[model samples]
Target: MSLRTGETIKFRSVGERTEYAAKILSADEDTIVIETKPGARPELSAGQYVILIAAETNYNAQIMSADASQVRLRWLRTDKQEYFRVDDFFPVVARKVEKNLLDTKASMTVTFSKEAIDRSPPDETIHPKLWDLLVSLDEKLNLILDRLNLEPEPVEAEPQQVNISASGIRFMIKDKVEQGDMLEVKMLLPTTPMVSIVAYGQVVSSECLGSAGYVVAVQFVNMDSEVRDRLIQYTLNRQREIIRKQRQLE
Candidate 1:
């Protein structure tokens, strides 16, 4: 879709999932100049990514600049890139999934398991809680195997801080991994069923955390759709919990 000047489009900041309308000032194949709507404040920063969605089509773009008057955006994709103008940028609802990706503490484990590792089935084909029980049994089995000097399935130590969402995760590790390294991530979501998701992620960014360790960030390169939906639901529930706690305190 091509948008002309004076047209508005929906805009969303990637990190915070903040949404707002922006009127187009000028546009081309790759870049667009949009005017932020009056009285609407979008906390956008340069170098951050944003999504511009219109007519059910979404375009990912990088924020070049933003001020009271206008925001500059550069399209992230070359293929299927569309121009926009002359439409009202409406505020889009926050993505519950993305919002919960913020840094949080959780019981998570990360490891460099083989990429093609075979997935174990059904955990006794019982309830979700039963599945967790099966996992505990498996852990006990591993411990037994260890005492016998047998090489059991490797399990890493529990992660201290796991910043996760359906899209990716960031955590601190003792060893530094090169950017683009692929690893397996297993996360136990504290939901009703307490879902356990095993997925593969590619290291996107890594930095030294000084005396603590190295902070590594990974983007989910592969995951099941159902698993992603569960993450969204888990995050939404977490948000409600925080609000409830605050109300009690007040």
Candidate 2:
């Protein structure tokens, strides 16, 4: 899968080897930027550029610059940007396909095959719920995902702007989250101490943000598996209802 500007991602912190769920703020061959959540909040512009590791894929990147709005980055392996971008999008012209020029274009539109454009570093996919879950992240969470090494899909750039913020959805462990386990979360309003009704989840990812705190990514992991898929269905339904009512008022 090739990387693009708007895709969602999950990457790990290099040193402590913590996992952070993130979105690609921007990506170039040499630099990239991400907007993360929670622990890195209101203080977004001031936090340090953490060392990050990518789970499964073994992708690693360094935070070159950071702020409340975004964090700049440098990939250590390729010594380039980590995420693939529209600029990198291109069609497999039988000729250019040789040079794979189109594979490296960044114009927001490109055509390629399922096998031809392996833009992702490796082991990344477009998990349907990942982006939906990312819609409500805080500054600390922002910090975490901004550096995400997402499972990527080879996407053709669309004109619509890619969303970079978190899921406004905040998480809490219904049970103690063990290493490599699942958890639960809630849909909260976007802000510090974000609050909301209880929901279910899983721990797909985690990161120790140092003595400061821990950054973990949960994929509505188990509520669905247990409640026999009841919790997720309910949560998604509630979100739709809320959107419906919101549109009605508007």
Model 2 local distance difference test score: 0.36
Clashes of each: 14, 65
Listed per candidate, the RMSD to the true structure in angstroms reads 15.1, 22.5
TM-scores for the candidates: 0.40, 0.26
> What RMSD value applies to candidate 1?
15.1
Candidate 1: residue 130 Cα off by (Å):
24
For residue 220, model 1's alpha carbon misses the true position, in angstroms, by 0.6
Instruction: Summarize candidate 2's per-residue lDDT along 148-209 as a digit string, tens digits.
Output: 12124322211121111122122222223433332223222222232222333323344565
> Largest lDDT belongs to which candidate?
1
Candidate 2: where are CA atoms >4 Å away? 40-55, 79-250
